[model samples]
Target: MKVSTIEPAQPLDHLAPAGRIGVVALATDFNIEQDLRRMLPGDTQIFTSRVRNYNPLTIENLRSMAPGISAAADTILPGTQLDAIIYGCTSGTVAIGSERIAELIHQSCPGVPVTNPVTAAVAAFRQLGARRISILTPYTEQVNCEVAELFQRHGFEVLNIAGFGFEDDTAMTFISPVDIVNAAKNVCDAQADLLFVSCTALRASVVLDEIEAQLGKPVVSSNQALTWHSLQLLGYPAPVSGYGSLLQQLPV
Candidate 1:
């Protein structure tokens, strides 16, 4: 073998990836993983970290998941750089606060962009030109009220909010799509320009297209918007169809 000491005329072409995004998913979450897989481009890679979560999905229980987030994120391809990290629970993000979650995740992975369902939902609503949004949730009234207030605080008009009246976090995942669609119809209003399905555990994307077609407006869901916004933060906001209108219309 002959070895050349001189430098090559052209440096080797660098290999770049589409992007790498992270999700700090709850241990009990059953849908976020699949939903993200369906929406993200084939070139993009996802890394997950499942944090501990308790039943009832109370403010207290939701907040308790925060401590495990940093450690969970640390496990996703250790020593590898990430483009963005998403705290994947919608209500949990509200209970814990997006800024605070971002602050906590950044404690271990500094300077990386962080987002949650709440922040991403708001951004999705904006991108879809929806100011008056009808909110549908699988939570009880209390959590719905808190989330309504949270959305209003961020300047979205909550035309109506209807919950399935469930408090069990794991059970929310079991609620049939038929029941969710019914609850959405109950909350759907003429004054509302958009419909929002909250909760990462609830299977909203299964009926996302049907709901949007029936209501003649856009429908944004927890996992759907989370993946879209996470991709947006990584500068890959191209149109993705069949999941929802948010991803199909939003541009980078």
Candidate 2:
């Protein structure tokens, strides 16, 4: 598993030469487009679809809207030439369950590869050889507990779990990168093999390097893990840096 760092590359000189990625977002308030613009290669084109007012940070909301969100994603992604499509909601993926969501995306896009953030996180944990995980999020207690249960059901041990008790998914984007690092440190423990900062709205990538150094362990965030996984599925090696050990160490 050789990891590559994200460095300055040649900018896209042609408008239509690069591949396109479609992301179907569950929440209207997330700033994923802005953050991904900074992280992804300049050659890639990103397209987004937003589900109106849907929030996965709450268990009741997540449970109520999983099907609708998946259906919305399916409906919004057709007729586009997407190399891949990613479901941008981590908890939504978990709430609906990965296999079902993957099935829906495949049914919608036919041959195109489909991915979700939660599936990516699980893959990242496995690739990092992490068995005991410390989970952190900007979700309510119910959502956080559900996330822990989801992980445990998937065979990973949740050594610890904590969250910021935020019910507003969109408001999570305002949490600064420094605060994200601090929150991770607050919930992380020596018993855990990895720290999972679970939220796409938070600017986890901006502080991944610092957090990994402080914890001396791999730190994975929803967006970072999904980005890494999405690239891998697109047949590109993980070649990004300034994040953390997961991105630094390529998945096997």
Candidate 3:
């Protein structure tokens, strides 16, 4: 009997085709992954990273937690084969400093582009021609102050900032989308060209479209901006609709 020989598959061929992005999220979060999948295009995949929680979401805790988060990214990335990675926390990135967080992730995964939500938010603001931004957050006063300083250092004007003063990060995730939209309407200034609903935990994405329509300006949330930026970094110009003006109309 003659037997046909089967050819062995190449190592790279066995792996699934790499998408444009990889997102590393906090461990104790809400359904950020599910939300991302629902919001992003089918071609993009988000990878979550495990990191320890240092409560209060303060700057000191963020600084203390950077190594663990970076290490988590390093551990999860090699197997996934992603084009770019996003550190998926707005407050975490702001507290740690966007440049510092990006550098750390880059050091861990060389040649892999790293972006943070804070940096992405700033970039989105610039891209959308926003000069004055109204900020909303679910952080304590201290953390909010740090974010304001970080944005100021990056050269964007902060017209107003409001925080819900919630100390727990997980609890922030339960905030209603309608509440976020109402807060934006109340805090946003007519002079401000953009509204920034800051916090990965907050459910800002659900109400982004409504807020933008009501205010007649671009509305950006932590996860939305990061996802868009991550996709852009991966060289995928995914046209996202029904989210906000930033996603629907802004150029990648």
Candidate 4:
């Protein structure tokens, strides 16, 4: 079996993608790429690496997974130069702290923009002018409390939060968009300016607009927020639409 080599004869200028993004995901996750890639334009390319994780996501498990993320970030396609690297987990980011996660990512992909759901969610809420938000997650209540606390510490008011009481990432991936839509409705807070569905594994991207239409509020899911944040850091000019209003109305 033979693999093709890079065509040296191809145009040296702009021959590759306009931007490259590296996403470090959980070992059990299965949907980050399917959702993020469709939101971006064809000019970009995606690279992903999965860190170790397990089911029954206790606080101890979440905290223990933090140390291996930087090593996983190092596995991205070498020589391509990532524009941004995102640690793609909601609950894990809460446990590790976004600042610490950024520090870890920059250690490997220095000078590149670093972000995660926690960081991206904060930025997305700011861009949407949403100070008060309702969050829906597929995590156990134990994990949800920390996630709520994380949002509060970031200065957003968590008007309400609802979780599916799930701990397994693989099971979270199997959660249907309809179930997510229903959960969004159940957790809808009339006082909230926006709704946030938290979980890269939840496949909420496909149903974001529908949930928005039903709730009459913009919805920001884990993958959508991360995709928009990545594009913003990359300084991509084109708007990433159809995912939701968050991507369409970014600040520059």
Whichever of 1 and 2 has more lDDT, that candidate is 1
Question: Where is model 1 more than 4 Å wrong at Cα?
Answer: 1-16
Give Cα-based local distance difference scores for all models: 0.86, 0.77, 0.79, 0.87
Q: Write the number of the candidate with greater TM-score, choosing between 1 and 4.
A: 4
For model 1, what is the alpha-carbon lDDT of residue 30?
A: 81
- Residues 31-114, candidate 1, lDDT per residue (tens digit)? 888878877888787889899988887788888888888888888777889889888899899899988898889888998999
Predictions ranked by lDDT, top down? Answer: 4, 1, 3, 2
Alpha-carbon RMSD to native, per candidate: 4.2, 8.9, 3.2, 2.9
Assess candidate 3 and give its TM-score to the true structure.
0.89
Q: 185-209, model 3: which lDDT tens digit per residue? A: 9999889988899988888888888
Stronger candidate by lDDT (3 vs 4): 4
What shift in Å separates residue 126 of candidate 4 from its native position after superposition?
0.6
Candidate ranking under TM-score, highest first, comes to 4, 1, 3, 2
Clash pairs, candidate 4, are none
Best by TM-score: 4
Give the poorly placed runs of model 2, Cα more than 4 Å off.
1-18, 74-78, 250-252
Whichever of 2 and 3 has more lDDT, that candidate is: 3
Candidate 2 per-residue C-alpha lDDT over 53-156 given as tens digits, one digit per residue, 9 for 90 to 100:
45445655666665555556666546766787788878777777777767766666677778888888999999989899999988888888889999999899
TM-score of each: 0.91, 0.86, 0.89, 0.93
lDDT of candidate 4? 0.87
Please give the lDDT score for candidate 2: 0.77
